[model samples]
Target: MSLDTPERLPASLADYQALAQANLSPDVAAYFLRGAGAEQTLRANAEDLAALRPWPRACKDLRGGSTACAVLGLSLDAPLLVAPMAYLPLLDPAGEAGVAAAATAQGVGMVLSAQSAQPMDHVRAEGSNCGWMQLYWLGGRDATMQLAQRAARAGFSALVLTVDAPVHGIRDAELSAGFALPPGLRAVNLDGLAQPQFAPLTSGESLLFDRVAHVLPGWEDVAWLCRNAPLPVLLKGILHPDDARQAVQAGAAGVIVSNHGGRVLDGAPSSISALPAVVAAVGGAVPVLMDGGIRRGVDVFRALALGADAVLIGRPVCHGLAVAGALGASHVLRLLLDELEVTMALTGCRTLSDITRDCLGPSPF
Candidate 1:
């Protein structure tokens, strides 16, 4: 069901987290909760959010206040979109539909994972028409083009090319939970590949790179992929400003400044910390978005004020879905949106447009 006749959602973002935590199972909680290895970047994501203190001002108009912004020609009611996550069936049966409904209720976009259990068409039909599809680029050139065409036909407006994960991350938690993708819910778009593979994680001394080196995309491959996609292409898993500049130069319409939420790489820098430099590289020529430690609307506020045209959320929404279906997911989104509105009002920013660089103090990083 959709959240059409909503009677105001949760007051605080933490309330959603608490409610969701109670509803989720052990595996679901761990999968959404843990980062790779030590979670240095995961912890740092929150710390960095706190660093961007909002410098208060004498409010001109607090009454006419809300948080809404436009990114990459898509007008989102908030400067946030649901991040692309795989296999929601593991958490809730509704899967992509639940996420789409939740995002729809919030009047924002949802990035549908290529690794989703549901087909692109089913998920596409769930929410508003702004759903984006993230592609992993299997079967090389011809197959990639076919998949992109399918996404466009399925009603997705944008293409999020995941460049970071040539293979899967070093997910110890998934391994321990015996988190294998069961037969019932394989990637619908990638049904009959001979050898489906995620990126090979580099071992400390295990020289297995040669075997899987063919899977990962170099800058040249990125350039080629960007040229082929019909929709606006946004490169995900971007960290360095140089890479951000490279992405834009390679014809990437946008870049998501993410370290895969510290999931793929063990000790990479936090996504939030990388935002400023990457935003500088893009020069706002293209929309620069990010994901990774967005639990609160204040985090949402922090991301946008720090030059991020938009932000993507990964864990919190998943947590909500795990707990309840569309209900929990909608609740989580409502909490964030509500808090963001309150934050804008208190900070003297009348609307999302008023939340500029000047509203923020020094980045503590």
Candidate 2:
């Protein structure tokens, strides 16, 4: 059942991406590659990620291997998790299932998107025993509660409530490429009437978001989400320091410092750039994680050194899936884990605990 054979391809993340780029279509590439709106935050996600470095300690032993960390109370074999990016059915018919298979093979879990091409239940099936639901809260209490109950019934272990995208922002590439999730492929959990303000603005006039806009949830809804959910809830898209504190107050189990991969707000700080203050605000009351422009194993180390309890990956895994289905996805994950382990060994950090803020160089912010 193994889908990995890195022997025939790129040994590092960069090399794998180069191969993936040549194989993927331009529009598909642009969707994953381009940021939403102006993409200012998207660029910062990568630039800020590159700015931090881990300080290595040479004398200590590392044969014991890398640190396995947890988030939102889930014990993961590694700190990496697949961030929820919708429309996998477009990339490969397997969609979320493909991502789930690859994630399980790599000994990790994947957050299945509510906006998935496949139904959340089917996506959960692909990631069953290792799946978590990535929610963008729905119309009203009954609607939101219904999905939550279904996810719990489907055996989802957690909930990642995305707080960004209160309104679907402008995505230039999605517009330029003429991309829109078709009606047949609309988010099954969020169907409703279309509206002018929240409606898709393309020439195609895709009613994707419009049909579902009435059900969008806010802070009050977040509390309701956590209350009715059976498992831990991780509030994704947390940026402001106060938001982090408020999330803890609202009973969120954790927070992912994400800006929707720069797909929502073009001017927000990189998730990595926003980590420290959020971590400080929560003051260790809640676990803080991040996702955005994380393409390298070293990027994982950099995020950890900056005080992120864990990190999430977006484009690269999609690239892997797009290029070779499940096998390609697994390859990308394994490569990242291997790189993280190597860095941990070389830096004399043997456990996740050994990777602390002290190991980082001066703050880039």
Candidate 3:
């Protein structure tokens, strides 16, 4: 059975979080909430945003405030996009399809994870032609090409290649809780794709670096993958400016400044902290987007001011999905857009272009 729509809908991301926690089981909540190791990077991701103070302006014409922007030729009503997250079925049976309906209704883009519970075709058919597919180089070159082709055929406009995780991070919280994939859900998109198989380890070999490293793709492989994809390719999980430049050079159409939502590398720098250098490095060569620690409309404003072409939201989307099906997800998007509009009006910014660096104070970091 689906959850009841609360009398007062969630007005803030924190509200959604609390509601989601109350509705979902302990293991499901842990999968979404906990980060790798001690979660230092997770804490830092939010803390960095809290450190930045917006310099709001007053006494200006506010009649024309709008939150519209175009990224990589996709015109969105707001700069907000949903980040690709796996196993939406873990939250609700609707999964990626529910998200698509919500995103389409709200006029925003949704990045469907390759590790999703539903097939790309089914998810695409649900709603939102403004969808992008997130690809993981899981089964090597041939498998990667197959998934990209599938996404294109399924009407996905863009391909997001996640570069941060060659292997899963050490998620201690999930590990300790024995957080296994629930019985009914698995990566349905990857059903027929070839999967990597490793030889049995000898007595003394290291399990991580020695065994797993053999199957991982290198930087050169990234170029090859970019060349092969039919859709515009964006490299996600990029932090360093040098890597940003390299990605553009390697034919990446865009780069997302993310540290895997602080879920991949425990000590990695916050996406907000890394946004400036990467944006400067790209220098308008390609679009630079970001995702991590985006809760309030002010956080979205901060990211745009710091030089991101757009921003992606992760946990909040899941929070909505957990609380209600399609309705909850759509409501979350609306809340964010509403808050962003209010922020723009209050700050005397009339449009997306007006949300510039000058609107911000000096970075605390």
Clashes of each: 4, 2, 0
Which has the greatest TM-score? Answer: 3
Ranking by TM-score: 3, 1, 2
What TM-score should be assigned to candidate 3?
0.95
Residue pairs in steric clash, candidate 2? 138-215, 139-215
Instruction: List, residue by residue over 13-114, the lDDT tens digit for candidate 1.
Output: 565667666766656666766777777777787777777888777746777566666777777788889999888888889888879988988887889898
Model 3: ten consecutive residues of lowest lDDT: 1-10
**Which is superior by lDDT, 2 or 3?**
3
Residue lDDT tens for model 3, 1-365 = 24355556666889888899898877888898788988989989999988988887889887766787788877799998899999987888888899988998898888999888888888888875447999887748998888889888888889999988877889988888778887878788878888766667666657757667767777788899888778889999999988999999899999999988878889999999999999999999999999999988889999998999899999999999888887888888888888888888878889988988898877666
Model 2 stretches astray by more than 4 angstroms? 1-7, 189-216, 363-365
Candidate 1 vs candidate 3: the TM-score winner is 3
Clashes of 2: 2
Worst 10-residue lDDT window for candidate 1 reads 192-201
lDDT of the structure predicted as candidate 1? 0.78
- What is candidate 2's local distance difference test score? 0.78
> Which residue runs does candidate 3 get wrong by more than 4 Å?
1-7, 199-207, 363-365
| Candidate of highest lDDT | 3
Cα RMSD of predicted structure 2: 4.0
Taking all chains together, each candidate's TM-score versus the true structure is 0.90, 0.88, 0.95
